[model samples]
Target: MNNELIEKGYRRYVGNKIDVYFNTNICQHSGNCVRGNHAIFNLSRKPWIVPDNATLEEVKRVIDTCPSGALQYQEK
Candidate 1:
């Protein structure tokens, strides 16, 4: 029983990998995720990154655009 697998289960079918945790306290609302696809990441919404909204591959592409490591992805 891997905790990482459990967390990823919460958002299964969304992405190939998952972003475990992110500290937004020092994060600046860069809007990198939303800029490309509002359907995926919306600052106005809760749990900002909506894996269910878009395919995992799409999410990965946007995540790479993040200037800050504030966004991360790990395989389950």
Candidate 2:
């Protein structure tokens, strides 16, 4: 886990190959994330961002669409 991100108010979502980080304060609500991959970014889900729901490449691809810099990731 990244203490720095946590300290910055970014929640961590652990995965086998990568860990996802999300800061809601910085989210632009562009809907790009959910549109890019519903499986990984489902709003109706409890933990909306599930990195393991998709492949590493897919996760990266979807997160890259976050124009607000709200979604981030660190590969394990």
Candidate maximizing lDDT: 2
Model 1 C-alpha lDDT per residue in residues 26-58, reported as the tens digit of each score:
346787767978887777787666665777678
Candidate 1 wrongly placed segments (more than 4 Å): 1-17
Error of 1 at 49 (Å): 1.8
What are the TM-scores, per candidate, against the unseen true structure?
Answer: 0.63, 0.95
Clashes of each: 0, 0
Give the per-residue lDDT of model 2 (tens digit) for 1-76: 8888899899999999999999999999999999999999999998998899999999999899899888889999
Residue 40 CA error for candidate 1 (Å)? Answer: 1.6
Off by over 4 Å in 2: none
Q: After superposition, how far is residue 16 of candidate 2 from its true place, in Å?
A: 0.7
